[model samples]
Target: MVARPDLTAWRPAVAGVAEVLHAHFTDHVYPMHAHGTWTLLIVDDGMVRYDLDRHEHGALSDLVTLLPPHVPHNGCPVTPRGFRKRVLYLDADVLGEEHIGRAVDGPALDDPLLRRRIHQLHTVLAERGEDLEAESRLSLICERLLGHLGRRVPPPPSRPDRSGLARRLRDLLDERVLEGLTLQEAAGLLHAHPTHLVRAFSREFGIAPHQYLTACRVDRARRLLLEGQPAHAVAAGTGFCDQSHLARNFKRIVGAGPGWYARAVREPASRS
Candidate 1:
């Protein structure tokens, strides 16, 4: 087969995600190198064999491989068909320095839920106006990864009611709905860890913070659209990055696109 390597890499606006890369490589071998950020990888089409900290690992389609920051690793395809993979380069702060040794010890995870969550995170990160969603997804992914690495400590037996914290987060999200809010910003303002904030909000509200924010935006967009505002303007006025972003969320929540919803509201039905 001909040697052709396809790759796309971009830095998202989300805080923890340093970079996102999707690649399909044939006959391309990666030399031993280290990164300043965590490498979270998933193989889509084929397998990748890599060595991390003098031990070998395989990145299979079902596995979520996490190569810790500052750890040396090299990768190459397992077959002539090569490998197709998606990767997320996360900032060191996401996982902390304490987990690097554990990750280096066992870089590949066999958990299906983790692999699925990572996939969902990649999908959210690829979108322009989905920073909040990306942050939420990344938080869960990191939490699961920490669990996999045995870095997560169990909470105390006494469980305090975090409903107040969740309400505060909801209020903050409401105050900044139009301006947009990041998970880190919310965590800082609420004086809670990102994962804790996410858990609290989800548990109290029965919905993820990102989902709540999107619903709010969509509701606002509906009002604006009915008030004779164009779909594009409604998008900009309601915190969406663009008309398409608004359309995607609007359709999901409202069962129709912004333009269609607006038109349906304005147009009178024919008399029988």
Candidate 2:
């Protein structure tokens, strides 16, 4: 039987924004629950057993995976050697508008570049290497992912009109996609009750609170693919746990595979 775990603050921004960089190295027990957005799990050490959508998989270094929203899932460390990781919770709406990224169960890429990006994010978050310097490093890391992971637009004029909390939420998500933000976190950041914030955000955003968040991640992923990044890089750089997860989300909104879409763009002759 699946064990249901108790609730902790459940803030993805703090937990998901940067790599968790676990020092505990202990098994993590989580109960099955549905989410509003996709989650990307990046394993840095050892392996993990993930029960996602009622399916299980064991993952180790450089492995990436995506978990869709409203899909029940659970995670358990494979051993006491345990593991350390960076989890990104993707925002789906963004996927549709921008990137074709997905949120899966593990790391998005085994590529050295992807690993370097994660390490850099982790390092900046942990060491705070320098004030402006660290922030610059963090921004560059995200920009590289965007270059590798996001597609190009017509320019700022063509950008969508995302404002207020929705805009802030989306901006925050460009780097930290798969993180789940609690109602409290939302309220604290937005200065409203969890319920009020949800309603207001949904009302103003033209999508549910959670759905908006999912979009943010998806958009970034889309942009990356459009810009000529590979599937694995898109998965890791944009915060989809892995390529499979990116495929799932990409199919949902674009109605086709990212590879196929990218091919179409690259080979204009095929348009005939």
Give the per-residue lDDT digits (tens) of candidate 2, residues 50-75. 77545577656765454556667777
Q: Give me the candidate number with maximum lDDT.
A: 1
Q: Please report the candidate that would top TM-score against the real structure.
A: 1
TM-score of each: 0.93, 0.39
In model 1, the Cα lDDT at residue 256 comes to: 85
Stretches of candidate 1 exceeding 4 Å from the true structure: 153-160, 267-272
